[model samples]
Target: MTVASKDVGMMTMIENGNEVKRTCCSSNSGCGSSEILVEYAGNEKWIQGVINTPKGVVPVVSTQLNFSDILGSWKARWGVNRMNYKINPGLYAVGTPDNESPVLVTANYKSTFDSLRKELADINTWILVLDTKGINVWCAAGKGTFGTKELLTRISCTKLHEIVTQRTLILPQLGAPGLSAHEASRQTGFQVVYGPVRAKDIKEFIRRDMTATPEMRTVKFTTYDRLVLTPIELVEAIKVSIIAFGILFLLNLIVTIPFGLDDFYAYVGALIIGCVITPVLLPWIPGRAFAWKGWLLGFIWAVVVNLINGWPQLPSYSLVRAIGYLLVLSSISSFYAMNFTGASTYTSSSGVIKEMKIAVPIIIITVSLGMLLILLNSFMGI
Candidate 1:
């Protein structure tokens, strides 16, 4: 089949193959075409079959997610090879879409793609998947992977013009940062329409003649939303704790003392305060800066630990240990909480950089002093 539209061109040859590809011609040629090959057991779970289009046969996807999809999403949340959780980027059909069907665009991240398709269960539409290196739409947009260049290149490579009669493509509202709608239209002859902020609101947005309601446009970071982000943080913190435990063990050996269970519990408590407590109580915690919030909780926790260990009634070394724990645990918690800015909607790039400039130096100084105190007390009996 020969496909041509606007400035796009393509030729499809259906044969025994496991996947579809849209290869671009050399830039030196001053033109390019999409080459599609459909039929692959590898994508059988998501791909139901194929629908014959005027340009070629497009792989059809089920709108309902299966058990594997749910499990994969869970694994990704826990940071299990999350970066590898992506699909091959290309054009896909949701239901039996025709040329006049509404075309939606999304990233190649499997979870993001799944979220969109599951919401489109009853809608006949075309999904244009962009390669975003396994990142979600918002992050990819910020990183420029889901920008105007990739959008135009994908449009040409997929010969999207020939596949659909409509000259409009709907993109997620969150992806607006990296792309220029006018530039895309000027280059590819397709109008870009931004949809709702959430995939769940997409059906309603489309039903209302593609007009997004105010609620659909507002991005909310609710308790549940913030809660879901903690799993990965918790998992990563645990991994770091293992290495930290090893380092602590070596340090204790150097000081000729056994690594105490109280010290272990204290450190673990700091990790929990940073990775779990701080995020859960984010808004309620009396601070605008996440580092300050975490440090407050960590300081409180250190005092409680010292009180329980009877450090106040013990020797001067015990007092030094209390002070050391306070500084070190608070610093650790602050560092982790600062890193959470990347996952938060409350922080901007400039704001985070400014906060880091002030916080990082303080954290480093406190941690160094704390470690020095602990080591000196152990080594010199001070």
Candidate 2:
């Protein structure tokens, strides 16, 4: 319980690291919930309800996130519906836990916190939610928001020593990047033990005495995982693509460029092929680099579009226009496809840098030459 929790009218029934509760109906400060609050112990303002145990009180929460929570999480994934969706950070008890109960640490991002807690529905444990300002553990760990300093600060603020007799803290494996076990143990006197990569595997980890299998240690970015991450990339990309396409269509009408509405529409089709199809068909796309994969698909798409429009029998400068469109579309496709490298597991930092070094100048030169050729044809009155 926090100092504020204690001030709401409860005295500590101190145990070997367990909570004591008292009713606060008489006082204004008390536990509350927008939904039904099962208990109103004045001190535990954060808990909606709790279960009493021989060692202390275990706050009761629904094992499942309601529709609202699920919807909010989904929206958050797309950077909408309040992207920083979060919950308060502090200590929470999963069930009636004794001093020997496991203590699990996690980021305060509501999605991660919810995932961690829900998986512990049948297990009695203590949860130490660290404040990461609504950022998920993996990203926060990279940003240092989930670092050792924050961990030590939270431990001190929660007075974790007074509540638990054990000296072991189970931390998520993803958070290890920001935390040093030696530093944490030295500062808090609690040995930091890295848990499995997924919360669902925690039970198996515990059953095996905190020993993780080889499978648990490996991180797999499967097709489904990559697929789920595509929506945000697609949505953000299309917003820009729409604006660019509209500008090109408007410009063609005003300037009578070699490219026309058909070309504009073709680019839109290319955008779809780049942002959506490329990601979905990543593994099958030829080439070791993402840029080449996208270019190959864009080139094929351009050919198909041209074939549908009478390839070899067209007006003067029509072939030039088609070539220009292909150049633009291929460049656009290559750029868009490469963006996914930052989101997926296929590319490392150095590899991405190397790919960019070779692809960027080519994209720029192709786009510039395509525009120059189209403008030359337009000026020639062809």
lDDT of 1 by residue, 1-382 (tens): 2111222243233323644333333242222433332223444598887787765667889989999999999999999868888875668898888889999999988899999999998889999988787889999999898988888767765678888888999999999988888887787788889999999998998899999999999888888888889889989989988897888778777775456787789888888888878888889999788889889998898888888887687632467777988999898888888878878876888888888898999999999999888777667656
The TM-score measured for candidate 1 stands at 0.89
| TM-scores of all candidate predictions against the true structure | 0.89, 0.80
What tens-digit string does per-residue lDDT give for candidate 2 at 159-222? 5676688899999999988978898889889999999999989989999999999889777777
- Candidate 1 overall Cα lDDT vs. reference? 0.80
Best by TM-score: 1
Q: Flag clash pairs in model 2.
A: 17-163
RMSD of each: 5.6, 7.8
Q: Which segments of candidate 2 are over 4 A away from where they belong?
A: 1-48, 51-59, 249-253, 257-261, 313-317, 374-382
The TM-score that candidate 2 achieves is 0.80
Q: State how far residue 359 of model 2 sits from its true place (Å).
A: 1.4
Error of 1 at 150 (Å): 1.0
Clashes of 2: 1
Worst 10 residues of 1 by lDDT: 1-10
